[model samples]
Target: MKQSQSHDGSNAQIGAPIPSWKVLIADSQPDQHDAVGRCLASLRHDGRGVECLSAFSAREATALFGQHPDIAVVLMDVGLDGPAAVQRLIEHMDKATATWAGPGLRPRVVLCTRDPDQWPERAAFEATAIDGYVVTAPMATDRLYGAVLSGIRLHASMIAQDSSQKGMARVMVSTAGIFELRSSHHFYFNLLLQINSLFNIVQDSLLFVVGDSAPKDDVARIRAASGRFSALRNQTIAAIEDPRIVSAVREVFQNGRTVQTNEHFAFAIKTRYEVMAVAFIDGALGLSAMERQMIEIFRTKATTAFSNMMLIDELNASQKAAVFALARVAEYKKNLIQGHHKRIERLVSETAREMLQRSFHPEELDEDLVAKVGVASVLADIGMMVVPDQVMHSTRVLDGDSVELIRQHTIVGWEILRDAATMLRGRSILAIAAEVALSHHERMDGSGYPYRLVGDAIPISGRIVSVVDVFDALISDREHREAWTVDAALSWVTEESGRLFDPLVVKAFRTVVARIREAEPDWLATEIASPALAGKITTAKRDLRRMIDRITHLLN
Candidate 1:
């Protein structure tokens, strides 16, 4: 599968397009001739795609190299002319000093081999003018394209950098020339303007200074751009409000490179901004070599302007984390097993990764989300801290007040998160987990707590975590109830899908549960036999009792 796509930072430049470059191939074997010829010909014959020139032998290759200075690449067969042909070819290349020696002529030579191991002069051949090597038998077209593109891009960058350096050197030597300085400034501004134009700024597009200490108006403009972009597109910008993205962008600036995120960040210059405007921006925008180079240039020119803003933000996040930890600590005093947050986070993080890959949803989950899910999972049960020990630990029949107190925990979790904006950013996944914690008790038939968000109204993430939370709770015991059999719990959950849970999320949850059971059947079996199960089964008994009660109540 060709699952790879090429990307570089900076939108595609709308400069005068360089003319298509030609390729040359040198090989002696007639049997090997057709395949190589056909592939090169295919690229060229694809209509203004590429131009190819072929040579039958090393001698012919040298002649062609001399004849066509415009040829961009030469694919040379290492074992072509004879048993010693590959070595001979290397000698010729060495004599000519052709390795990165084509000045003004950007010809990349890649050694093509049937078997790199079998090649007699493999090391010598590799050490010569070859920019790269491509294995020939059953050649993968995608790999071939990748190799070719990589070589070409490298060659282009080298040439481009050299040209820029030479121009700068000339300007430095003639520093007294006003016209040279003026031309250089104009060149830079023009480059920026042209690149901006290539981004195809629509009505929602607003320019913002992207460095750390950039003007306040710059940050405001970006926020405004995000709002306009989201409203025009009618999409939620929660990702923009995510803090990880801001961290990622800071990483890019610190390293002087382009940072990309699908999580909604219109853009941030600093590390502190908790909420960015939510918009799904393509990551390819910031992954290109050109984008990295351009950003490096930008950072060099505006260091102080970007740094001041980001440093302040870093300090703010540190302070916020400290306060949030303190609050969680105070709440934990009432109910222990504070480790539930960490455990749940790990479980959900793993499960979400599986589900994201298995399904075709547009969740755009990456490593960042997975890490956040783990952290948020721990905090999911933080709300349980709000409930009194009597209600949480009771084995006797519970009264309405106790049930309500337990129910309010979810709402409390949400409220707590809303107040901590920094946690809100790094732990956006926590918000989803918080929502799930708040409503995990809800039934599919609009019987859930707080908002009773029915059907799709409950975010997919909430539903996913809800199922996992319930599963973990079910297999574990609580003071109020006994744990249920895994089979019984799965059956009940599956039966209640759509009415009590998301049908798809439920199915995915089941898959995850099944996998875990397969990987460690003894853990499930032991938990089923003894609720204590090494003191980790805190909620198992209560869960089993609740399951029995719910099932019996439903049957009645």
Candidate 2:
């Protein structure tokens, strides 16, 4: 309830990189937007002025905030979206504060209402991070200006003191990448690196993740050492010879409280998954009382981020397991070859990774692209489950109508994936999977399937999967024909070129195919009757010219 100084452009940092502080206004009234915008028109601080954003509805407000993570302050009309909507928005912003890595910043919230009788109860949202409260009735320009300026100041102050928050935010960013880790080795080791970076990176510090002493299915040994002890980055504790450090780790794990001395510091935090994480700092311990308090808070925040990342990985693993089960069900109903979907997944992953490695399509291959494509590729032919058995396996040659009906499988698979739309709405693998399911059959030249989407219109994922899907299907057995030879399959893909595949995608696919041929020429020669080559292909040792030569015989 404290007042803010009237903005006279005195506080703005001159020649700073930022030109303005973005202020988003959420209200349904056309006049209100104009009023707030006009009031702050000339308002400047440190040479920075206010840029007002207007959102007319709750959905609009959600979208605006989602798009503009740099929004410094949000002034909302509680009566328009109502107090309940405002509370939900506040809660969302709370969960999001530690995830942003941009400018080391967080948004400030102010609730405004025209009616005193309809004021939002302070008790309901006080626990949330609302920075100011404004009542419009009998309100003066100075008071309004004070409220808005106060919100911006609060935001600036939060940013100024964001050392700990930014630490937590960086940890969250790494933890977010945890969901995309393709292997457990990378997951745990990368997690250790992230956790160590969250601290002061003390040399001679050691971290011990003690699992259940008893032999259990999930529990495993993990320990890491840094600084003077950098040799133990990915090492276990079984080979330790330093009795003093070993004993210190033991005492901390046993007592489960942070302990420090003139030259040593130790702390333990029990994770949500029932693992004891104990760290012993072996460097300087000159931290004052306040510094120690801040360290403890940082530890708690970092630990929470770790737990949340683990939970997301678990959920993603479970969802993928279920999707794989569904795909297996589809395969069973149609009596398709074993590991049909698995082969396609491996091929898609292999081809996509090659594209990324050689910079064929850099923009499309973000961090999660590998894991997302891996999970989503299995659902590429999931639409086949909905196809009637007669159409799926009719011995007689089908008419145009039946062929078209078969083509509808892509749409059917997409609809099934899209059913979980609410949970997979963003730039996530599940959404990418849904898109691939619907559009993988689409061709570069508008020559293939139900949609006939061309060129870049087909998602990069879809284009990658399309090339993999056809090659896998061609080289695998079916009711109609035996699996084609590897040489024949690659030649067919090459022949299609711009007609059936993205030229760049095909170029990448050819190299991947050549590597597969080099490593396992047997998989290339005969029909792929089983999951014999379900594993990912390793990097090829040969030059690109040799790969072309291996396939040139077939191309001729």
Q: Which model scores highest in TM-score?
A: 2
lDDT of 1 by residue, 230-323 (tens): 3422122233454554455445434534445432223322323432221223222323344444434433332332243344344443443443
Q: How do all models score by TM-score?
A: 0.40, 0.56
lDDT of each: 0.52, 0.69
Model 1 spans with C-alpha error above 4 angstroms = 1-67, 70-339, 363-368, 422-434, 523-556
Compose the digit string of candidate 2's lDDT tens values, residues 8-117.
33332212244478888888877777777767877675456787778887777777878877778888887765677887887676667667633425577877778756
lDDT of 2 at 16: 22
How many steric clashes between backbone atoms does each model show?
A: 36, 5
lDDT of residue 505 for candidate 2: 87
